[model samples]
Target: MQTKLTRFSFIAAACLILAGCGFALRGDSSIDAKLQPIYVASDRESQELSSSLKRQFAINDVAVSKRRKEAKLIVIVKLLDEEKRSVALDREARDAEYALFESASIELQSPDGTNLRGPHTLQQRRLIVNDPDNPVGEETESTIVRAEMREQLSIRLARQVEFWSHQLQDQP
Candidate 1:
């Protein structure tokens, strides 16, 4: 009985310490209420990003509007460039590894054309290994890597937007 009580006490103390230190488990990030009903404007090249952003916003309890006129905040995402460069070469000079680079510029604003947060550029890269004998496999693997990179980029962009929204709201 004494041992169980001591263990319980230790666990309770650890929980208090963690809470006091502001340690929180990973979960959906909080977004500012004022930034809800957002409009995401993207060019054809950034359609995937826009879709991902909308999904993320929904997950975070923020409303996304299909119509710009109905939104209080607007987020513009533009695909700047995409490049695939060979990073490694085989003994016979064939490409062994490649790096995929994707870059985009993002802007946060009000519906009335007020710049709220950014014209920030975000870049992401992913490495792919080429199977010299299997061209089809290499192509498929590269596509998968690019998709994964895009997903990661979207998560990062969403976090940045959320952070900025909180910061702007806190300002007097």
Candidate 2:
């Protein structure tokens, strides 16, 4: 009984310390009420990022507007650019590993077109093994890596937006 009580007391103290330091879990972050009815605008090539952002906003209970006219805030995600480069070579000078780079620009603004946060660029990279003998296998691996990179980029973008929203809320 003494051991159980001590353990409980330790946990309670830890929770209080964490809360006092303003540390919050991911799901505990909330959006500002004034930033509701957010409009997400993106080119056709950025559909994946736009969709991912929309899903994240929904999860955070932020209102997403399908039309720009109905929005108080606008988030623009530009089309993604992808590049492939050889990063490593075998003794024979052939490609042994390749790096895939993907990047996109994001901007946050209000209805009046005033910038709120930034026109920031977010980038992601992944290294893939090169299998010259099996072209099909190499292509398949590249596709999978690109998809994974996209998901990671989306998560990072969501986190940045969340931080910026909190900053906005903290303003005087």
Candidate 3:
């Protein structure tokens, strides 16, 4: 019984220490009220990116307006470039590794021509190993990596918005 009590007390103390240090698990990020009702815009080539951004906003309990006119802020996202190139060659002179890069441009503005966040580039890169014996597997792995990069870029964009929102709240 004494050992059990000691163990419980230790666990409780550890929890308190972690909480005091500002350590937190990632979850919904709060946005300022001034940036509410945001609209995400994307061209046909960037539809996937827009969809992922919308998902991030939804997770944060933000409502995305269907009409641009109804939004207090507009977030425009465009795919700028994508490239896949061999980075390594095997002993047999075949491809051994590939570097994948993707970049997108983001801009935040109000409907009345106020720039909240200037145009900036968000980029993501991933290095993937290629299996010369399995061509199909290599292709599938590359595809999966690309998808993950897109999701990562979306998360970054969401964080940018959160930062802008907090900045607005701090301003006079």
Q: So what's the TM-score on candidate 3? A: 0.85
Please identify model 3 stretches exceeding 4 Å from their true place. 1-24
TM-score of each: 0.83, 0.78, 0.85
Order the candidates by lDDT, highest first: 3, 1, 2
Model 3 agreement with the true structure over 3-23: per-residue lDDT tens digits: 999999999999999999999
- Tens-place lDDT digits, model 1, residues 1-172: 9999999999999999999998876467577777677899999989998888788878778888999999988999887888999999999888899899998888999899899888999999987878898889988888888788777787788888888888878899
| Clash count (model 1, backbone only) | 0
lDDT of 1: 0.86
Worst 10 residues of 3 by lDDT: 26-35
- Runs in model 2 deviating more than 4 A are 1-29
- Evaluation by lDDT, superior candidate among 2 and 3: 3
lDDT of 3 at 9: 100
